[model samples]
Target: MTDTPENGAAAPTAAPQITSRVLAQYIRDMSFENILAQKGVTGDAQPEIQVQVNLDARKRSTDNQYEVITKLNITSKTKEKGDPLFVLEIEYAGVFHVEGVPEDQMHPYLLIECPRITFPFLRRIVSDVTRDGGFPPLNLETIDFLALYRSELARRAESEKAKAN
Candidate 1:
């Protein structure tokens, strides 16, 4: 302000501003292991599968950017010898610029839209891996991220309601 501009007026100072808004996506790792059950059911085998998906959400040093990672583990096999039929691991991430978004609206954006945007590619990769593994192509069940998020919210609300009741 160099002596307050010599007129009893304060000099203008620079205010901090938001720097960057970017969405970066990458595939960290993926693996498909098919261990065909040996000397066990092959024909007429009603293969049983166990599907598990895990999500990890994180915010970096920046206030506006967030990362949502989804990991899938699929194990499909018969019930005869406890053998592993197919195991798939997919680790994928989506980064988003969430600045200016209300705090109340953050959960849905991360849990639903981010994952929905990342799922089709993940699904395609899984299908390709399974098909190339000399087994029937595995078509993953459709994921309803919005529905899942809503269900979670509803469950929480119900629990609170029950507690109050």
Candidate 2:
């Protein structure tokens, strides 16, 4: 038995279903510089690593398609003397076909959800690059996309406010 309206009628509205598919993913650009190897640094030296991440999203010529690019700049140096160790820069991009998301939410969906879907592959590449460059594998911690999105929005707001002043 189903609960019906007082007049014995059924509900007429349902929410739209959201669907997303990854059409393709690739490394758009990458560069790894082994500064330590180039400088010939020897004798057990400590390593300090820094990583920076940036994101961009743009619409494709095709309908319902968008491209999201994640850019990472990584550097490693010796903790003791602050000598250079290695630097890795990479841009990874994904093509997604998305449907049913509201227009207002498309930006966040593209920046956050799409990157979250493709992050594992990016992580693997970073780890492999570091290991192959003669250092231990560098495993990155999980990123909080929601927090990142909010921070970026706040930054843009401040920039616009300053420009107006």
Candidate 3:
């Protein structure tokens, strides 16, 4: 966006646009707690840390296409509280609607834009959960939405190419 003016006459801008509106949002579900049972890991389990992560996204079929939802879950386990730690599972998902929009624009917005809008809350949740679990806040690393978008496109392209062949 830019302002253009000459001779003190301002160019008229287009009418106000509301891209998407939140229909309804509430905590779908949430849980956070510390597992004191973890202490037994040091006595019996192998000295190993296990980690797994996943991501999923979906869009509503309604015409408005203005509603989006995302959830992130992370579970960590270590050989012992004082030993190396690992993320047993990190499942993140997003639901979005981009109706009345051009496909070219919506693709990136869903993959990148929506996440940009939602990541802060997700990050705060992660940090708070970790801290409440008796560990230092899990200040997550930054994400590159553009890179993720490119990767999604590449994956789709590869899948289509494979189908064609």
Candidate 4:
């Protein structure tokens, strides 16, 4: 605790310190499909890619640690035929040791921070797998975890308010 010069009262304590360590991370599932090879679609055109992401976290009953999973699905297809070009799906998970976060903030910390720590590894895997699967390496864009968390919170609040109404 630090003392203030002007007032005789002591200053407030520091904010709660939060620390996170990744215990382990692994690929729970992975799939890379080159639809052009399977369907023999001849095309020299660049395919439009679409990516989707999902996050889930749960507390382990045994050790009180948290397990966070980040799921990503990427698909590319032509504009005219809408035929599939390539599909890549990955489910990456990590065990995180989180300390000093308050109960009210724990959920967001686990969902956002833990995944933020583990996403680079998942991104690398996606790139490597696509290149190995005979296609150009697919470099994914960086994600905004904080925006996602805030949006999720707002959506939930709106849903509850609707139910109450």
Candidate 5:
């Protein structure tokens, strides 16, 4: 039953509340190779690091459940000699139970928001792996998911435009 105002007009229905929960998070795969150690390079080496990130999302068999994966590839090379230092690759995934997000916004929510929730853990793992692999801990700067998403969209638009021409 809807509550009516004193004038007896019907009240508008309220919108459904948005809800989301992370069901599980895990490192689906990871690998770290210390190339400097294998090469027997022992002097003080300044490192230049490059990091690449990619995201993916897919629906689960269970209703209202989705899995999002963040893939990272990181490489470090010596600044002076351009020698390989190390390479780290990881795929991290989160399972989320979500409700009330409009379909149009669901893609962004899964790709942007879910990865935001899981990134800190992924960063910590990177730092730990680098330190354990015989280099100083490599702390990653925070990622701007919104900017990344926007750039990806722009790239796709450019690709489509090129194809049409």
Candidate 6:
């Protein structure tokens, strides 16, 4: 037993902890399309583009690691009820080695942090694919990961409340 100089309490001697996150990243899946099947399908009006995004995270059985995936789907059409111009879909995933993160913090870390690291690559891919598909490069805007995470939490809470009712 040892005593501290001021309070007469022994301080435990332990090595400092090290926390690691996002060890590696890679594109798990990607897809692009030009439904029009023609180089320039220029019509009288510019096509309307719709973008949809989704995110999911899960823990690995190996422990202290997680898999995070971000998927993006885009569609372009002349109007609400018109022939589709082009469709693009991408599913990107990353393997993250998270350590020393509390259970409460793990969810946000995976959904927000992991996606932040992976989005740039995904964005570049989208741009390249659209360019090669014979259209102007589609540069995706930066996603609001924090807002997405919060919305997901709210959705889950609403679902649980509905179940209770």
List TM-score per model, in order. Answer: 0.68, 0.91, 0.57, 0.90, 0.90, 0.79
What global local distance difference test value does model 2 have? 0.93
Give lDDT tens digits, candidate 6, residues 8-53.
Answer: 7677676546376666677777777687786445565356888899
> lDDT per prediction?
0.76, 0.93, 0.55, 0.87, 0.93, 0.82
What order do you get sorting by lDDT, best first?
Answer: 5, 2, 4, 6, 1, 3
Candidate 6 versus the native: TM-score? 0.79
Best by TM-score: 2
Off by over 4 Å in 5: 1-15, 42-44
lDDT value for candidate 4?
0.87
Candidate 6 shows a clash count of 0
Worst 10 residues of 6 by lDDT: 38-47
Clashing pairs in 5: none
lDDT of 4 at 18: 81
- Cα shift from native, residue 136, model 3 (Å): 1.0
31-104, model 2: which lDDT tens digit per residue? 99999888867666788889998999999999999999999999888887888899999999999999999999
| Tens digit per residue, CA lDDT, model 3, 19-112 | 7544544444565545444433454333332222223345666765544444444555554544433232233334444444565576556666
Model 4 over residues 38-150: C-alpha lDDT tens digits? 88676664678899988999998756489999999999888767888899998999998888999998998888888899988988998898888888888888999999889
Q: Write the per-residue lDDT of candidate 1 for residues 75-105, one digit (tens) a residue.
A: 8877765666778888988887766555677
Compared with the true structure, the alpha-carbon lDDT of candidate 6 equals: 0.82
True-vs-predicted CA distance for residue 108, candidate 3, Å: 2.1
Q: After best superposition, candidate 1 residue 118: deviation in angstroms?
A: 1.0
Q: How many clashing residue pairs are found in candidate 2?
A: 0
Model 3: per-residue Cα lDDT at residue 43: 49
